[model samples]
Target: MEITTLASTWPAALTDPSGRRQLKPRTKGRTMVIDKGIGLHAFTDLLATSGEYIDIIKFGFGTSPLYPLPVLKNKIELAANQGITVIPGGTLLEAAVRLDMVPGFFRQVLALGFTGVEVSDGTINLSRGLRNDLIKDAKSLGLTVFTEYGKKLFGSRIDVDDFANTAEQDWSCGAELVTVEARESGKGVGLFDERGDCRDDDLSHIRSVIPNLSRVLWEAPLKEQQVSLIKTLGPDVHLGNIPVHDVITLESMRRGLRSDTFELQQVPFLEYMI
Candidate 1:
């Protein structure tokens, strides 16, 4: 059967088991993939197979500067054509801020065709004024701004009050989303513990304070972290830092097609099994 027809033939009970949105330009359930230097062919393959499931693509760290100008622009243009927001990693932004090159950075990003910017202080300290300015600057340029909370330091944990305050400020400054930092390792930072376990209490507290959970994106690079966040926050929760190869796998878990979330299906079993 053709791929489009296969879903139609599935048991009615199995269709849309999780009732989550499946189309692109989705407001919630966003997935942000981290590109840690994949080649153009690999990148093209990723977009070909899984672009529909992606909402954003982050060029990990300062590597965006290292890519040949033409290659970087091509990648950004490809993602834009797929309706995916492309951004340089926050670390690069932090570097720009430190070097007093924020203006040049934004110009380069826009000229290169990136559609968004990640304003984060993961590796360095950014004053509230500076952070807000960065968000505003990006917004003034008609760029999507995604602000990140939490530090990248090992064993860094979330302070609920601080997070709440920062998130509010970020939104007021025109940030479209606020991401909680879990780094690429998905361990010992923000919501994850040293062993990469999701800190349930912290996550719960964050959800309680943040009225619109859809505006919050949790960086969950590990499979276990993804599973835990989805199970706790439901499938529509925004997750980021996903590896390229795992895009389909993550979408499967979100839609209840995978065993981890199979029970998320609304219908009871066996009746449709035969």
Candidate 2:
């Protein structure tokens, strides 16, 4: 499928500060936004303004079932048409797993026009075998599968060995990416400290064990966290759980348009040679 990027209308004098924020269909530097009950009009407005910068739109948590059927369907359809993948929050799948409704989950997902599924165990105990099956099942139905690591509980931290093992297994099972959970609040969870700051030691540990960083998506909902990850990992790191309104802001930071990363690129020449 041909992904259409917004025209690069600006002059060549302005280069991305990081020097390599590729346009979609991009395999790296992906941003996944979270939709917390946004209406149809607002959803459409967001897509119209910044859809190209977004890779996925997750209907946050269990809120996916709360939307009117038509609104939900339209939102998924719009995202798919714009080349953006759409999936229900991982918590929804957890609910299905708990209730033994995995089949229904996939059926409803496809019936609703969602292009992806997030198989997560943040709130439930999913055996590794089950997790693998879920990933494969989603792939068999032609959905892009995104499995997640980390628990949703407060103060939960990632286990490097377990995470590395699970990530490899998930990939072998055909999952596209593995998201590290940060919940909606990015504090005291996963790689974040109590104050929403990143735990660099933990991040480095994870990186050391994982062979490929490109397959992992860190959920950084806060601007500071996003900036920190972009600076530490370069702009190609895949990030998730971004709020809808912050799409352009995150993209700006990715391209070094913001002060936090303005030094990422060489200084622009003051003398224009027209």
Candidate 3:
């Protein structure tokens, strides 16, 4: 069968049982994948296969500098062609801040064709003024700015008031969204406890503070974290730090195509089975 015909034959209800926002250029239900050094071919395959489900691609934790200039440019071009916003990991920006090389960093990032920039202080101490300045700087360059809230320390947790204040200031300074740090391990940091489980009370408190949940992208690299967030926040929650291989799986969960989220359909047992 032809590819278009094959796609046409699939029932929409079966494919997207949860009534998710399926199209891109999405303000909500965005997924940001973290690239921690996948080869060019794998990266190509990822965009080819699951680009529709991805809204942003983050070159995780300074890995953008590790790629050859040509290779990095090619990757950025590919993602941009698919309407995906690409950004270097925030750690690299933090490094530039520490070295007082902010101008050079922004210059190279624009030269590299990155469509966006992440301003974060995960491993560094950034005063409120500096943070706002970084956000404004990226915005001035016509790059989409994504700021990060919370620290990356092993036992760090989000203080509700601080998070609210940071997110508010970030938006005021022109950040499109602020991401919560859950690290790649999804354990012992930010919203998750040492066992990689979501702190329900904390999550609830944070949710209460932010009326528009889409403004906060929660980094959930683990399956359990993804499931928990989906269950708690509904299917349209923005998620980040997703592993490349799990893109399709995460999409499945978002659309209720997987058992973990199948009940999101709210269909009767017999009707679903049939």
Task: After superposing candidate 1 on the true structure, give the runs of residues whose Cα lies further than 4 Å from its correct spot.
Answer: 1-15, 268-274
Clashing pairs for model 3 are: none
| Candidate 1 per-residue lDDT over residues 22-87, each given as its tens digit | 688999899999999999999999999999999999999899999999999999999999999999
TM-score of predicted structure 3: 0.94
The 10-residue segment of model 2 with minimum total lDDT is 10-19
lDDT of 2 by residue, 46-148 (tens): 9999999999999999888888899899999999999999999999999998998889988999999999989999999999988988898899999999999
In lDDT terms, how accurate is model 2? 0.91
Instruction: Give each model a TM-score.
Output: 0.93, 0.93, 0.94
Q: Which has the better TM-score: candidate 2, or candidate 3?
A: 3
Q: Per lDDT, what order, best first?
A: 3, 1, 2
Task: Give lDDT: candidate 2, residue 200.
Answer: 96
